[model samples]
Target: MLQSYETLRQTGIATVRAQIRSGGYASHTAGLGRNLLQANLAIIPQEFALDFMRFCQRNPKPCPLIGASDTGNPILFTLGQDIDIRTDVPAYNIYRNGQLVQSVTEIGDLWTDDLVAFALGCSFTFEHALIEAGFELWHIANNVTVPMYRSSLETVPAGPFRGPTVVSMRMIPEERVEEAVAISARFPLAHGSPVHVGDPAAIGISDLSAPDWGDSVPQPAGHTPVFWACGVTPQAVIQQAALPLLITHKPGHMLITDVPDTAEIPIITNKNMPR
Candidate 1:
């Protein structure tokens, strides 16, 4: 029998990956493997691999490069002992010439010798830390994907990859915002702290109800929207580049890794604590 989402959260990472690999679990990966690292996927041919690596180097916040597979290889040895990139991710967004062609549960048929898979750090890695600190993430509570937006903020361009930065939004209580920021900053690989807080208009986001990706989460009274650099920025940039081929993990459908979250030990300082 398939385990409940709540039950799966308490399960081991390998079991979760197994379920995902078999097409048994095809949902957003938020709140799963709370202590494990999760990554965003960006697979392209070796011809554009160098440029993509440079792009990630130039834009570290949204594209924190964690691991990459050798050309034609589907195994991400650095992330896990048995992760097969072709099937480990719950879903993949296929693109041809920068246009989304389809979304699929697996990409084994498309895996080729010239393809190189890059894994970028995802903000989902730090979500557990936020929850442990008593911050409420409504999307997870409601079993929906976190809301993501394409902001007016520009990314540092490299090669053919350049586009406005993408961000994930979380509605946090106004009073606990500072602690949330401080706690999250410890996970730099997870996009670190929020890039913007409060007022979506300040960052070129005009509608809170309409998101470019993921589900629109509720905004309760006295809560403020906090935005973090999102790994999905690569999808937007790759779209602009119009590459002949591109495969990325569907937004919020990430590859959970065997590595544990490397969040730094929190410093007990009065300044960082909530007022």
Candidate 2:
């Protein structure tokens, strides 16, 4: 079983698809690939795709656009050669009128001809970079989900999509805060850089122990909770928008793509241009 775990960790897109097809693995995709990109999934009607795309463009810090599928197609060739948006993710959340209606292992029955799939860069990609740069992550070490909060900062509105920016918090030792920032700053697509360094209440979070999503890990002595813009922001915005129908990967159960984690850097060359 340990070898099977290791095999899944090292497996590529094809192998993962096979496993997901066989119902052998149905959990969060975290820690599965050492250097592969995992993505946040958002599926919406084709009628709303353009507006959502603009929303993402306007709010790139929280909604970085990584890969988008063609209209009415579940295959995201740009993200991976054989990617199937419907079943690629480990788990999915089905929402109707902005309320979560069900959690499913796959969306084959829910898929429709008018649906459009989106693949957004996730901060998990940068977590690997942080670890590679010698920064320790508390959640990975403690085996807990990274805590996420809805920040006081508001995202720029585009169409009907507007809401508070949602951020994921990580506890970093005092000495390594700079290293964490420097490493994460290199991946803007994956919500690069720290939005807040200390004091959870500064960002509208009343208590660090309580998070809107994910399990909270205890902050150790001499460490501060560092926050970063998260891909979950879009889900929050969609909830607020009260869209008639929406679908997303369940929190932590991300879509693993064939895209190499090192394929893109987060640095912005044109500051004036939308990210």
Candidate 3:
């Protein structure tokens, strides 16, 4: 039998991935594997790999490419020795011709020889930092996914990948906003700092209650809504490109990597990457 969510939280990173692979857990990965590096995943055809890489390069803040699997490879040796892109993520969002068609726990049947997998830095990597620094993350405290929105900020275009940037929001206590910013700024691979600090409307997000992705959290008194550049930007770009097929980690459902959040992973890696 699968362990309960609370019990699983006390387990190791590999155990969490094992549970996810076995269909024992298929939910958001926010607080799981705490302080361990987590990644946003995007798997597409090898033909578009170069352009996609360029897109990530052009928009490092929103699309910090942590690692990319070798063409047609399902195993991400750099991220984790046994991290199989096909079934490691908790859940996957299937995009067909740029439209999200389905959500599944695993994509083993859809894995193909022509596919290329890319792992981008995710904001969840910094949540532990904040919590350790004594900041209360409303979403996590309430057992909900952080609220994410489609912002008016445009990303640098690269080939067919061009779209508005996506931003994740967290309600930070007003006085400690600066401290929160300073702490998060250290993790460049994990979306270093706050892109917008105040009003949601200034960035084209009109409603705090309705986010484009993830669950919304209530704004507590004396807290301000802070926004950060998110890795999910690729999904928006993929939608605009109208690609024939694309697979991505379902919003907030990430690939839990063996790498510690403190480690800085290069944009690309080979078999030599340290475990």
Candidate 4:
């Protein structure tokens, strides 16, 4: 029975990667690996590596650099022990001249000697932390993708990278807003804390139900909508740049890492709320 539980626990991650490698699964990867760290994928030519690295350094909030590969290499050693960039992710978006041209399951045909891959920290890491802290994540409960919106806020630009920051929204009960804030703030890499809360339209979103990407979850009754910086921001910027060729993991289908989640959270406060 003990071994059975272990197998069940790893099933989601293993099955998803297997399907992705076999071309059986191709869709947004939300709520798939609930406990593991899921990463946002970004692949670029070696010609733009130094400038892009500086861009991430300038705007750490939206583009928290998690792991980077050597020039002309696709294998990310820091993320996974045996991660093959060509077939590990569930879906791949191919862009040319900054326009999305095709979406495929793998990019073995497109792998080149002058390419570099970057794995950025994703919000799913904090979602696991939130769940463990007893907060109810609406998207996970309802089995839908978290709502994402393009915000008016602009990131610090570098070279050809410049665009509005994209944020992911979650509906939290009003009473637990402070608790949610305290829990998420611990993760500085995966977009720590809420950027904006309360009304969606306040951040330039005209309608709460219609998100630019992913399915919108119902805010309902007494909950307040909260937003955080998302990993998708880099993808948006890349699309706007219109490079000759670029690739990224499909939204939600992240690259799982070998790094333990606890390594990211150093301090824990049990006071609940200050008196």
TM-score of each candidate structure, all chains considered together: 0.94, 0.91, 0.96, 0.88
Compared with the true structure, the alpha-carbon lDDT of candidate 3 equals 0.89
C-alpha local distance difference test of each model: 0.90, 0.81, 0.89, 0.78
Error of 4 at 70 (Å): 1.0
TM accuracy, model 4: 0.88
Q: Compared with the true structure, what per-residue lDDT tens digits does model 3 show for residues 1-275?
A: 68766767778887888899999998888878988788899899999999999999999999988889988889888777678888899899999998889999989899889999999989999998998898888787777788899999999999999989999999989999999999999998899998999999999999999999888788888999999999889988987898899999999999888778888774335664545
Greater-lDDT candidate between 2 and 3: 3
Cα lDDT of model 2 by residue, 1-275, tens digit: 12354467677667766777556777656667667777888898888888899999898878878888778788777776566788778778989999999998888898889999988888988998887777777777655578888999899888888989999998889988898888888887788888889987888989888899988888899998899998899999988888889999888878877667777732223332222
Best-to-worst TM-score order: 3, 1, 2, 4
lDDT score, candidate 4:
0.78
Look at candidate 1 and tell me the lDDT of residue 219.
88
* Better candidate by lDDT, 1 or 4: 1
- Give stretches of model 4 more than 4 Å off: 1-16, 265-275
Number of backbone clashes in candidate 1: 0
Task: Report how far off residue 203 is in candidate 2 (Å).
Answer: 1.0
Cα deviation in Å at residue 128, candidate 2?
0.8
lDDT score for residue 245 of model 2:
90
Q: Please, what's the RMSD in Å of model 3?
A: 2.0
lDDT of 1: 0.90
lDDT of 4 by residue, 228-249 (tens): 9888999998888877888998
Q: By TM-score, how accurate is candidate 1?
A: 0.94
Can you give the lDDT of residue 53 in candidate 3? Answer: 98
